[model samples]
Target: MTIHRMLARLAALAALALFAQPAFAAECLLGAPGTTQRVEVSDTGRAMTVHVPGGVDRIRNLPLVFLLHGSGGTGAAMLESSGLAATSDHHGFLLVAPDAGIPVERGFVWNIPGVPTITGEIPTEDDADDVAFLAGTIDWLAERGCIDPDRVYATGLSGGGRMTSWLGCVAADRFAAIAPVVGLRAGNPLPDDPQRPDPATCTPSRAMPVYAFAGADDTVNPVAGGGAGYWQYPMDAALARWAEIDGCREEPETVAVSDTIEERRYARCDGQARVVGRVVAGRGHEWVADNEAMWMFFWRYRH
Candidate 1:
């Protein structure tokens, strides 16, 4: 071949290879190993995306982690941004990211105010049965096999983070541990006012391990924000309340890891569940890169 023609052909081949690389990687990323399966599991028309590591058999009980997305986010976005799927691939666990079922202007939202009652009240468009949907999802995963029922855990950001708190309070029986990022309890007031429900009545079925992370400077959910609107309770106060709920006797030991990350842990609680709070120094409303550390914290507790 002529030198000029050979050079042109080589450049075209390189471009083709470059384009093929991402397509190949995406296929692998969205397939069997290190990928997710989309599932629709209810007459209620609820849908979820489940990511299972390759070669995981239905016989062995594998650890399951639920990664929930924030407001204006989707299951795929959470899996991509939180890096939990990569963690799942490395840690050999099954990761599931379920859609919140709320249609926002951009993406989807978790129905924070949509929890149901036994009165058979139908859920409105804004209302979602996220608690039941999650419970049902876990049950579905358990039936599929290879999932350890005792090791089911959950974590989320923003609105999803709020849903994680709701799961901890209302669906504690199903989850062994939970980590809510930049989210707090709705703490709805008591009485069956269709407008507001009490947070006090939403007691947990068991003491599950909880590791909370919030930026001291988070304007979206500030620790000092009044009432249940934002972070509501001060950071220390929220940790204290959780400690009290879990019956944790050990005082918090604060350890500054760096200029941007601080770790505070409360151990020796009832059911051996511990509460660890990470106060990100000078950070705002975002996920900490140390989520692997958070997962490690959540993995310690078993049902």
Candidate 2:
């Protein structure tokens, strides 16, 4: 062969070798099961801790869950407190806990629409685009063959829960289901239409299944919507709006989860959409059986 032709062939082979490398090679490598690894999520240098269960790669169409932290929270805190990583180990799904971009009180915070963050006491434009960052994270994992596109789920605490609700509003088509704990806030009613409620930021392209939990005695976000502090929707109003969006039956089935917790399941919905409201009686603003209940709720639906 001519020297020029040989050089061209060698260059082509080198290019092919480079293309064979995984785009997320630094992030997607399998680590010890249940061990957390922090990796970059996007071009902006955002990062999250991903936990893979044992034998995750062996399973087909594995489910993935995004666990978000509340205001003044971090990914490490969520991993330590929520016990979601343990759940992932038991269920053989991938778990990712992302750190919010906005910093507050020595921790991070999410940019929930219309909600006053810990960093900003007053409502204002969001400092970071968390929605886009999470969407990019999901796509990145999908590209790396780590997550099932049809079975993605999201759940979170207060500010993070509000962020989860925002996902249900704008990113309905991307997730199978969502469960927000102690954080259900609907938008104010539209002008000249008290009967119709408008959410803070919703552009739902599909019917999203939701299972929300709230503390009846939550002084921070009282279910009655009349407590002091910033104005927000009550739990019932938020559930009603979700039921309307999902086309669920008017009445809900009431079941007592515990002596203190009541579960209201909204049934007979379109596109397999349903909403379950778990009101923890006498409890304050905190999580209630969040890990188990949300897993059960999320497993029932798929994108």
Q: Candidates' TM-scores?
A: 0.77, 0.83
Badly placed stretches (over 4 Å) of model 1 are 1-31, 42-44, 54-60, 114-126, 189-199, 226-230
| lDDT (Cα atoms) of all candidates against the true structure | 0.71, 0.77
lDDT of 1 by residue, 1-303 (tens): 999999999999999989888331111122456557786764658777778776543324678888888877888888888877777766778888888876666677666554332222324765766777888876665665547788988889877777787788778888888898887453433344422335474578777688888887788767655433333455566566677778898888998878878877898998998887787878778886376786687677787
215 Cα displacement, candidate 1 (Å): 2.2
Task: Give every collision pair in model 1.
Answer: 62-146, 188-197, 188-198, 188-199, 189-197, 189-198, 190-198
lDDT of candidate 2 over 1-303, digit per residue (tens): 999999999999999999999674234554676578887866768889888786554534569888889888898788778888778888888888999878787889877655567654644464777888898988888776667888999888877777788788888878889888877644444544433357544657888898988888888767766453333557777888888778887698899977988988888888988888888887887766467667878888996
* Decoy 2 TM-score against native: 0.83
Question: Scored by Cα lDDT, where does model 2 land?
Answer: 0.77
Query: How many clashes in each candidate?
Result: 7, 0
Specify the poorest-scoring 10-residue window by lDDT in model 2.
187-196
